[model samples]
Target chain A: TQLLEQSPQFLSIQEGENLTVYCNSSSVFSSLQWYRQEPGEGPVLLVTVVTGGEVKKLKRLTFQFGDARKDSSLHITAAQPGDTGLYLCAGVKNSGGSNYKLTFGKGTLLTVNP
Target chain B: DAGITQSPRHKVTETGTPVTLRCHQTENHRYMYWYRQDPGHGLRLIHYSYGVKDTDKGEVSDGYSVSRSKTEDFLLTLESATSSQTSVYFCAIGNTGSPDTQYFGPGTRLTVL
Candidate 1:
């Protein structure tokens, strides 16, 4: 089973459209992160939410951490073709120490048509 | 500096052949990881090392092995390459005690025919 499940496995929309992606899990996490991956490259960290019920915004993208710490969401405002790529959500458990492995979601492949 | 580099950006090998991908870091972060990316499967952790010579398995550890003999080098080896193992491999380095935001390498595309 996937510890972190991302919805809308694939998405394609015209520029200026708004979209939201969801990441859910039954397990609580110490923190959750969002990443964007382009072809021939590794996933790049977009943001990390450490507190439950926390919300963070990165210009056109807004991220929310669930109050229960079991889920998160990413919303893109006025999406652009530059947003075309795979968006991934990963969760980290509190391992007491700094050494913890991140569980990744299959990711949502977003295509913003120009 | 959190600079992570993976060698052999692209490779193609036949089945039953041995393949090794190397991850080198200048961060000296004491933690290194190998992950494989496959279509519709996301990025799955293959192996991770907390320190030199101390490695652990991840969700998909079968048919793969790893070694970290030094702080800056971690190696992932496929004893007998198979088509199923063909995927883009990434290396990451991070400090264990901080926020643990991992820095990833460009990636190595390995194709086993």
Candidate 2:
């Protein structure tokens, strides 16, 4: 089974601070996706990176896929209280016959205080 | 947002009792998935359905069963509840063309005491 390891399980910062969360794995992935979930709600997809060294930006959030496709990262610029939530990284293994199944990381819980 | 709804948004049951959670979707997606979220464990897939009357077990299928009788409805059942099974359950719908992106329902919080 493939595993994605996320770093800094818990993070707390004042509003306007910049933060980056990393997800690493030994196995290469065909695709990687980022999701943010608020309390009492299911996860919502933030972005998806399919190519190595790919980067995508959504408003104040930026996501990058590693050159080796074995890791990914999410960077938040000027974090706000509204951005506080659980961030999750999920990946589809390169060798998996099916693309529907995904391996997920534990997640990073971010709290931005105003 | 996806047109997905889960019934019994919250449920509390005793050990050995049976419990069932219903998922309804209006998107008419071809794929539906069931997942359980636990602290520090992330989200684990319990089961999924490819089409009506067609389902498959996921990584954590033990003690859980799923049935899909219609395109818009999927059901998950627990034969005998256990404290270990207590967790937040989420239902997701996926399009046949784009399986990677799935839309999730609000979720159901189940507590087995």
Candidate 3:
């Protein structure tokens, strides 16, 4: 089974609409990260939340780590076509000294119509 | 971008052939990783290197092997290419203090026909 589960596998919305994508897990993580990927490119890190119940904002995007560190949510306000891409969430677990294992969710493919 | 590049951005090979992909970084980061991205499977780690000559397997380590002889380069090899191995591969470098924060290379698209 996938360790991390992401909701809304696919999404399509008009410009200016708001949307939220979720990443959930039954196990706790040392940190959670959000990434955005475009065609022909690798995923790019958007933000990282290290503490439980932590919230971080980047421009039009808001990211929150669950209080129990088992989940995270990414909310986009007034989304634009630029926001159209595959959003992925990964849970970070430090296996040992400085070696981290990242478990990625399937991801949410988003489309924003202009 | 982070000064990372994957050689032969795109390659097509036949099944049963051996193929090797290269990841080179100028950031001098101590940690390097290899991951595969396929439809329905966002990205899964294949292997990672903590330092030169040190490497470990990841979630999807089967059918794949890695070698890190230098701090700036990491190599992923497919002993025998299979149609199932056709996918985009990514290389990443991470900071020691914040391993979760990583920078990725453009990607290498490998088509095993």
Candidate 4:
């Protein structure tokens, strides 16, 4: 089973619409990160949240971390076509022995029509 | 980015063949990782390195091995490739600051027939 779960698996909306992507987990994590990936490129870090109940904003996108550090959400305001990509959320968890591993969600594939 | 590069972005091999993929980073980050991305599975880590000659297995390490002979290069090898081993491979480097952020190289697509 995946440590992180994201929904909905696929979303398509028109430009100027608003949407939210969620990542939930039963296990608590040290940090949560959001990444966006285009068709032919690797995923790029969009934002990282550490503190519980922390919130971050990058332009039209807003990211919120749950108070328990077990969940996170990404909200896009007035989504654009350029935002069409795969949105992934990962949680950082200690694997013991001075090592940390990232557990990633399956990702939400979003498409915005212009 | 972060000066990370993967060689032979695409490869096709037959079952039972041995294959090696290379990842080189110019940023001199202390940690390097290898992950395989597949549909519905997201990215599953195969192996990682903490420093020169210091490597460890990750969640899905079967049929795979890694070597870090130097600070700049980390290599992932398939001892005997199988059809199930075909997937997109990504290399990442990080752990530079608080919370540990990673930067990935363009992925390599591998196909085993």
Q: Order the candidates by lDDT, highest first.
A: 3, 2, 4, 1
lDDT of 3: 0.94
Q: Give the per-residue lDDT of model 1 (tens digit) for B1-113.
A: 36888999999999999999999998779888899999888999999888999898888999999998889999999999999999999999888566468888999999999
DockQ winner among the candidates?
A: 3
- The regions of model 1 sitting more than 4 angstroms off are none
Which pairs clash in the backbone of model 3? none
Residue B97 C-alpha lDDT in model 2: 72
Q: Write the per-residue lDDT of candidate 4 for residues B1-113, one digit (tens) a residue.
A: 48999988999999999999999999988889999999998888899888899999888999999999999999999999999999999999976454268889999999999
Interface RMSD of each: 1.2, 1.6, 0.9, 1.8
Badly placed stretches (over 4 Å) of model 4 are A96-98
Model 4 / residue A94 / CA error / Å: 3.1
How close is every model to the real structure, measured as TM-score? Answer: 0.96, 0.97, 0.97, 0.96
Point out the higher-scoring one by DockQ: 1 or 2: 1
- Clash pairs, candidate 4, are none
Provide the TM-score of the second chain in candidate 3.
0.97
Whichever of 3 and 4 has more lDDT, that candidate is 3
For every candidate in turn, the CA RMSD to the true structure comes to: 1.4, 1.4, 1.0, 1.3
* lDDT-better candidate, 1 vs 3: 3
List each candidate's DockQ score.
0.76, 0.64, 0.85, 0.59
Ten residues in sequence with the least summed lDDT for candidate 3 chain A: A1-10
